[model samples]
Target: MRGPAEAEAEDFVAAHTAIARPALVPEIPLHLATEITPIWQATEAWLGEQGIEPPFWAFAWPGSQALARWVLDDPSRVAGRRVLDFAAGGGLAAIACARAGAAVVEAAEIDPLAHAATRLNARLNGVAVAEAPGDVVGAPCRWDTVLAGDVCYEAPMTNHILPWLRGLAAAGARVILADPGRAYVPRGGLAEVARFRVPVTRELEDRDERVVVLSRLLG
Candidate 1:
């Protein structure tokens, strides 16, 4: 049975977005906003009226696209392993991990709307991804593999998350970070494992295509 928060999120997402496939990972379809500004305004209006945070989960980011493609192309990376998709907006990487045969998959997102989106996307892809809300950073690493997408966009978030991710890597958990050349992505510690030319909307990325890289943290 769905909880109240989940039901409310589902209703909000259904009212604001449309089901569409990301350009880079066309195999998986997701519910996404077609117009960026309108959705942002809508979410902002909702925030003013109902005190809800802006819905960043209603978009498929380039890093996630690259990560999802990499996972599908090389399923052995996550196959039969317990996986955690950190900051799992839209649950793209989580769904990919599940499809790649991960023994267990969990998506961690702080936003209730994102949790709803993850649940909906997992169901759409015919996979199971347990949605965990709230900050999971610095927690004891339980998964065999951890996947993070576009997490370095903000300096504060980068500072808070990178160390925890590196700790997990050091502890022998495979830590894969998909980054779109964000300013905060560390110059060292991460080695580029794969790269992809991800097509993205100009409104979101300010460019037609972004070269996203899948980097593995050196333990």
Candidate 2:
């Protein structure tokens, strides 16, 4: 589950290209990959630099980097496709899609702040992005693929996203969700495609590294 600190960091992102820290700050932040840069803080700083904060959700918890690992392993899934990053937070999955050669990518998030953060992070990572307001699932969209990461940590989001995802699938959109065994993960026909052991923190306890990956329904 994503923690409060992470949410706060996202809430504080800037809209300019560079940001100055106003205080020492008190949130324990985690970095992406084997780097020392805290992803949450970096995202906030990036947003601060940009100088814009859009409306966003309180806790669109992104699971432990599961989506990143998969994109690095097999980058072609996004190549030359129009992709949607549903409920995108910090735009990690969207960044992965951009890196994978997606023709066009959009970060569809509900929160104005999170949407701001997502755009900031995407730009920092040199990823191009388009923004779709509110929960983008039921809205009219044109996408070849849809990706979700760590959006199932709550019952409400699950209830809303699940049926919408299934509906997208039924409409011939290639959809994939990345999770690390989150509590609300549904028991359906989802088949694990890959897994990883990601380091977690105190707020996310009982984790012996997160097993992360994309899933497919196996009949």
Candidate 3:
């Protein structure tokens, strides 16, 4: 049985977003916001909570798009491996990993709305993505691969999560961070693996496209 809050969250997600495919990875269907401003404003009003972050899970960002594309193109990278999609907004990369045959796929998020959105998106794609609610930072690494996409946007968040991510790399997990030239991306300890030109809307970004870089986070 679902609690009232959980059911309301899912209802909000289904009501505010439409089922659509991201530009870079079109094979996987997701619940995405059609109009940016309306959804953003609506989320704030609906939540009725002050200082809530924008609904990042409503859209598939460039970093996740690139990560999903990369993994789907080469399933062998995650097939039969335990995978973690860190900060998994809408679980795009996580769904890709499941589709690519990962033995287990976990999607981690701190936002309860994001958790609901991920659940809806995963079901829409006909795949299983275990939810790792709340912060998974500083937790012991149990995954073979950790996919982090678009996670370096804010300095405080970057500072808080980067060291733990590095520790996971040191623990022998293949930590892949997909960055779309965010302001706070570290200048060192990243080995480039793949690059993608992802389409975006000017309403959300300064330009119509973002060049996403998939890199191995060096321990």
Q: Which stretches of candidate 3 lie over 4 Å from their true place?
A: none
* All candidates: TM-score: 0.95, 0.70, 0.97
Per-residue accuracy of model 3 over 126-184 as CA lDDT, tens digit each: 99999885789999999999999999999999999999999999999999999999999
Better of 1 and 2 by lDDT: 1
Over the full model, what C-alpha lDDT does candidate 3 score relative to the true structure?
Answer: 0.94
lDDT of 1 by residue, 1-219 (tens): 998877877888778889999988899999899877777778777555554555679999998888899999989989999999998888999999999999999999988778888888888899999976578998888999998999998899999988899999999898989989889999898788999999888878778999998889877
What stretches of model 1 exceed 4 Å from their correct place? 49-54
Candidate 2 vs 3: which has more lDDT:
3
Query: Model 3, residue 105: displacement in angstroms?
Result: 0.5
The TM-score of candidate 1 is 0.95
Of candidates 3 and 2, the better by TM-score: 3
Query: What's the C-alpha lDDT at position 73 in model 1?
Result: 94
83, model 2: CA deviation in Å? Answer: 0.7
- Backbone collisions counted per model: 0, 22, 0
